[model samples]
Target: MPHKVIFVLIDGLAWQVAHDCMGHLQGLCEAGRASLYRLNSALPSLSRPLYECLLTGVPPVDSGVVHNQITRLSTQTSLFHLARAARLTTAAASYHWISELYNRSPYLAVRDRFTDDPALPIQHGIFYHADSYPDDHLLLDGEYLRQRHDPDLLLIHSMNVDDAGHHAGYDSPQYRNAARRMDIFLSDHLPGWLDAGYQVIVTSDHGMNDDRSHGGILPEERQVPLFTLGSAFSHAPEVAVRQVELCGLAADLLGLSHDKPRNQELIRR
Candidate 1:
């Protein structure tokens, strides 16, 4: 059987950071026989737009999610919709409300909502405190969901690294420390899932620049890392992929046909 898929998005993680902290992610790459490539985020390079692109397999222009605040509910369908349509159990855990904003949960389930309340708006769905890092929370929730419901697809988004990068700069000690923490979390907690039968795909929405800001169109702001581990990937490609393709990689990984016109140019056979 094809292993279940776990998509982990480490927010604001740059290629340089991934390389610098290779020791943390190296084992996953080697064990799962994965490849590494640079993927470009959407224009403007914000979190919401890039994530919406990831979910809907559409560009920011097509998805109608250009900024972090504009909630485009009726624009396009998300990966969750496709997964649900296929009758696959799906779960999502994130540190930011943007994930919930783009991928809304049903009325009965828990929801993470954006708020100025500082308490981290929880409309019902498993909402972690905004003041705290939700990486471990998301991982534990994923494990719980897997054990109790055996969800076929799980999505996790960690934001501490991004927060640290934004506040302390990309190359600061805080940023590296946060990355290291994420490394430890993955190494210690996620290997069991891989052993049990799961294909883990770790990537980022976008990379941080030298000044730690990324709402612009630049190489650093665009290029992100892609690491696939488990039974779903081929031999690791030795060459670096320079093309600015984001949704194409995702579509390929999920075994979905690329329908978006812009992604047609980015798709690699």
Candidate 2:
């Protein structure tokens, strides 16, 4: 079988904070090709921009999702598009904006409904609000999607940590507890996915500062934790950590065709 991906995206999770606070994820850390990975989000470190960069492996200008006002991605080279080209099924769970990005508001069936563009075909997409859904519920939704579609690419985005960070401040117990609990929940479930032979990619879009807010270029805001587990990571279990461009990594994980460099082939390895 080919390399499938299960992506867990924790919002506003700083690399230092995730490493310091999320001990429950230690098993996954051990399962990975490296220890705590220190990586940079796209410039501006904002959620929307970083999401676009993640999908397209391009900067703000090319992705066409420069601000919060922009909901849909116009970039043709996005992971979704390339996944379609590779004939891989893709699914996602998270905020409603994600569904809106595919021009599907109100959730009228998130399976390959992009009428405007035939290239980007989403197998399934679920929308959840940050204030309402708990971390466990989000994980359940992701699991449900995984079982339902058996998608080749799965994206699980959680806002619990970011929401907690904003409401109680980044340094508060609430924020740390949020990350810890998320780790525990995923710790229980993620192994099953790995057992099923899917490569796991755990990361955050960006970090939060002391003010409990992001969208800045501060180190705390721009840096995020990146964890690669299963066979996709070829390095040793504890290689030297280094700075990485996250968007390119994401594109590579999904086997995006146009974005591949001549020297490196990710999905095959």
Candidate 3:
């Protein structure tokens, strides 16, 4: 059966921190309901660039989203576009940068923040501009979108963990607490998503550093975590997963044709 997917992008969450602090996800892995993999973020490891990479399967250098301030519509085809082309519905509760990339450019918060136009690549959206937007609110927005639209591909991007890492170091209590809080939120919502027949992939665009910033080559800045929870994935796969490959993986999960390379080892169907 073709699977509907809910992809949760937890911004700035590193492998170590996610491995340590996301106890609910970790418990799922321990119980064999999910699989965890180390994912290396695309080069330049910044939010906008990696976000493009995650959706387009194009590296930052190639996609021309080398920095966060580029603020324009994506030139490359994204997961949203591919899904829509395949006649699958798409929705997102994400940062405004996502709105800028896939839906519209120069996002007008007043008009674009809560979009539901079927003509758009993201057929439904609840976008936020602030980096400090609460993850709880974003998740709720995602759930609302899911229940209403029943999108085949739902993207939920939360920013609190990244915000906390920017305010405190990645090793600080605030950062860990942010991850823990998101874990609790996931604990609350994930079961419902799963029961609704949505295969879930929780991951991050990039990692965090002790300097409270990223865009560097440090492992802490490039090493993120990917947790796949659904029947479509292998219970144990040793394949190396890259951030760029996420687009293809998502496309594959949604039963769409994709040009990008997907880690087929990670899939059972």
Candidate 4:
């Protein structure tokens, strides 16, 4: 099947929250429409570390993205880097740090930061707006770029849920409302993607506590949901897998041929 994957990273979404806020997710699991598993995030359970882990298939000890404290991570063997190396198109709707990570690649990176830099190499597609963008904004912006640019691998990172979690507590109605908003985006988009030979992978980087803070080894912070749904794995049954294994699964989805030395090391870790 000719299939591509659009992986959506919902920040600070817990598995427990999925059943509560994202009822669509629970419906998918119960109806066997998707394989939903509780996967563990990398320790520290911070955003940057989990993102690096998802992209590089590396651990905090090696990547040095131990926390938000660490600034830049010269990650050369990540998904974007590998996609560029193999001549595949890439697109993302994310913040400045993520755009900076794609500086070397000819990517359709839409920087959704507060500051707008008109001189950025990739200008036409860049989105420099306020920090008040809702959770569904990521999906809407990503859908725009994918329809316009048709990137082979697309990433849309939603930030509002995490923000709500931090400000209004993880279990607060505000956080649930944000997840519900994203649910509408998924409902409207995912089924069409499935029919059109596209994989829709939705998961979170970490989970927040009731108190609305993260950055520890607590189970609430360390475990999140992982779903692989599309024509690529339509007949695949549900199974338990490591969080890092997702990196390999993504490469396989993209038909990426060469695994860099660092990726090879991922197999052993």
Question: What's the candidate order when arranged by decreasing TM-score?
Answer: 3, 2, 4, 1
Best by TM-score: 3
Better candidate by TM-score, 3 or 4: 3
- Greater-TM-score candidate between 1 and 4: 4
Give residue 53's error in model 4 in angstroms: 0.8
For candidate 2, list the clashing residue pairs, or say none.
none
lDDT of 1 by residue, 44-108 (tens): 78887888777666777876778877754536666656555655566656654544554443222
lDDT of 1 at 127: 39
**What would the per-residue lDDT of candidate 2 be over residues 1-269, giving only the tens digit for each residue?**
45778878888788778888887566555655434566777777777777766655566665667776775535445566667778888888776556555435444444422222333455576666545478898889889888988888888889889888888776789888888898888887866897888878788878888897888788888878877677666644333332234445555665654643222322235
List candidate 1 stretches off by more than 4 Å: 30-32, 96-99, 102-125, 129-131, 238-269
lDDT to native, each model = 0.64, 0.69, 0.92, 0.68
Write model 3 residue lDDT over 49-91, tens digit each, in one string.
9999999999999999999989999999999999898889999
Report the error of model 2 at residue 232, Å: 2.4
TM-score of 4: 0.83
Models sorted by lDDT, best on top? 3, 2, 4, 1
Q: Deviation in angstroms for 29 in model 4?
A: 2.8
Provide TM-scores for the models. Answer: 0.80, 0.84, 0.98, 0.83
- What clash pairs does model 4 have? none
Q: Lowest-scoring 10 consecutive residues by lDDT in candidate 4?
A: 260-269
